[model samples]
Target: MNRRHFLMGLAATMATARLSFASTGLIAPINIPLWKGPPPGGGGPEGRVIQSHSGALRNITVPGLSILLPSSPIGHGVLIAAGGGYKQIQDGKEALPAARWLIARGYTAYILHYRLPGEGWHDGNQVALQDAQRALRIIRQREKQVSVLGFSAGGHLLGMAATRPDYRAYTPQDAIDELPASADRTALIYPIITLEKPYTHTSTHRILVGPHATASEEAAWSVQHYVSSQTPPCFIVQAKDDPRSDPHNSLIMYDACQKHGVPVEMHRYPTGGHGFGMGKTGTETVEWPGEYKKWLQQSNAGG
Candidate 1:
């Protein structure tokens, strides 16, 4: 089947499950916009998210859902985390297209709808990471290896998933903690790693930790300081001109990676403002995905 048709079928199958937002008296059907065009190379978009039995996940709003399977079934997979300065997923700029890009390169890709803001940052924090961990576990249960690729806040959550201990946001009946401890690799596109840094202190940090968070919590969230040899191989790309999230964010991450002797590839481009997911017009950051693809191949993730 063609890409569009396949997506429709997938949606149909998964949509049978309904999400009831009774606590807020809202019931919205999950609608994900599809990209119009030939299956963008290595994979077409066909992904869906079913409601979990877990009650009322906070701030979790999935604007869309889609997955890109590699041309050949390679056991490895990537979970695409769309960034939204802690507000909303920049769906167009970062979500589906990012998955498509990975699929084009021959890796199964899954898009996630974790929690959102106004639902409390702690809830958002816990829910997003739990969703990612669950997604990874679910995919792995099916025998597919999985990693996480996120932009901005999504990137932040991915970092949390990688570094933080696996703690369920809610109590569970199952004895086995299905969450995957480590993704084979983490691809961060201009991620906000260190809220302790001046550039990251004001905005993203506030959104994540709240207006009243103490210095200790911020230090805990700073992925750079949290990095150890245990952190996964990370590939980061940042734009030098991004005043919103400075290049130093990636620089600190790179430095930490080096300090821990973990493999890291950091590319700092001259220009490309923040939130340019999958890269964008007339900037070296536009070449980042291609460069990252090459890096993944060289690093042994492409096989």
Candidate 2:
């Protein structure tokens, strides 16, 4: 299949994810527009909230957060960026499951519904990063503590946001942008870490940076190159057997962190190929969620 066809094939599966999220034991979440006025690029109305279609998510007209608050307070929040190769958000399978997991664990979770880079946004590659920064700022408004967790392409976006939080992807429109976009903690799962050769997921590379992106552009977009000591503590997990995203991705990020003196840890499973949200049942990857929670708790305890 071609790139679009392959991406669509992956997106088609999103419709069948069967998310009965009502059982997640969380109360209904409040939805907030990421931008108060027109979003910096001027795609549509300022703060326009688009009702997402029931089947498959695409053509994001409005970027917002579905804020899930836990009954038991952990005094911290997490912003989740779900991966869809920058073609879709995968809200049902990847993003929501992650939000539910966080909510159950006493985290106030913000599920980011960000713009797709290919959808005609001006400076499209930076569009998702803008939304992520805005969402993080909003969460910061509520409290000083917030973390970020990203899966697949979302990881790529967060990688840029976490490292180049001051890149100024777009003109800041409000005081909220004054808040730093940095995450207290970062987690990347089965992510697309590089926009360059050998190990890059071609479709994602194209969708985010374009098929003909220059070598310098690709290098600039690559997350590993931007790591610094100031970057947040990071946790990475991916199955070495993953067919879509390569195992090199996790290693690349870990190496970057190590080189920069940023605390980081990685878990490579023997099985469980890819897109195993909350872990595929009957697979060893199922242990990742628990491990992540333990890490988060320990990070909290250490501080």
Candidate 3:
């Protein structure tokens, strides 16, 4: 099934099993646009906000951010970026579940509705990264203990933010840019870490670097080459049998982190396939969330 249809079905399935944050007295998420006025580079006229049959927002022109506050604050925060190969945003499959899980564990959760490059947004290739960085800066202004979690292409974005905190998609406009883009910890799920041939997801590569991208542009985006000691400690989860994204993507990232003295942990399940955000219940991959929590605690303690 296409992503739109899959997301529609996933939304329907989730409706019946949705947890009520209201019952626990948690505040509903408030949507906040990434920009005060028009997004940088001028997004042209606002495009139609497309939605799936199940009412989930799909194609977007004006990107936004929402914070899901926990019932009891723990002083920690996480920014989540769902993946759709830079063409769409899969919030049902990736964002909501992860945000809910994090909130339930007392961490403030931020969900990013990042712009898609394929939609002809301003600075096409840089729109998503710009939104991601803006979200980080906004959250940092209020919360000091922040981490990032991303799936697939979103993971690529998060990896880039973690490794290259100084890289800017656009020139800074105000004080928000003064805040660091670094995350204290990062979780990458079946990520597309490289933009190199054979391993890179074609559609994502095309959207991010364009069809006529130069060698330097492609090399600059491949996160593996940017890993350094400053790269945040990362927890990577992937399936050896994932058919969409090569498991070696995570391997190379892990190797780079190790080589650069950046603390990292990886879990390669036997056969969970790609895009398993929370993973299937009763499967080995379902334990990833728990593993990630443990890793976070260990990293925090050591630091």
Candidate 2 per-residue C-alpha lDDT over 164-228 given as tens digits, one digit per residue, 9 for 90 to 100: 87778778787888988778999999988888787555567888768778888888889999889
The residue-by-residue lDDT of candidate 1 on 1-303, one tens digit each, is 355554564455345323322332223223332222211121222334333343212223232334545667566677778776665555446765676676666776677665454443334445455556655555565435566788877788787777654545444424224445467778888788888746545456877777677778788778877688888888888898886777788888889899999888888899988888888788887898888777666545444
Runs of candidate 3 with Cα error greater than 4 angstroms are 1-27, 44-48, 53-56, 299-302
- Models 1 onward score TM values of 0.74, 0.88, 0.87
Q: Considering summed lDDT, which 10 consecutive residues are worst modelled in model 2?
A: 11-20
Q: For each of the candidates, give the backbone clash count.
A: 4, 0, 0
What's the TM for model 2? 0.88
At residue 237, what lDDT does model 1 achieve? Answer: 83
Give the poorly placed runs of model 1, Cα more than 4 Å off.
1-65, 120-124, 165-176, 200-202, 299-303
Query: Ten-residue segment with the worst summed lDDT in candidate 1?
Result: 35-44
Q: lDDT values of the candidates?
A: 0.63, 0.78, 0.77
Error of 1 at 118 (Å): 2.1
When sorted by TM-score, best at the front, the candidate numbers are 2, 3, 1
For model 3 the TM-score comes to: 0.87
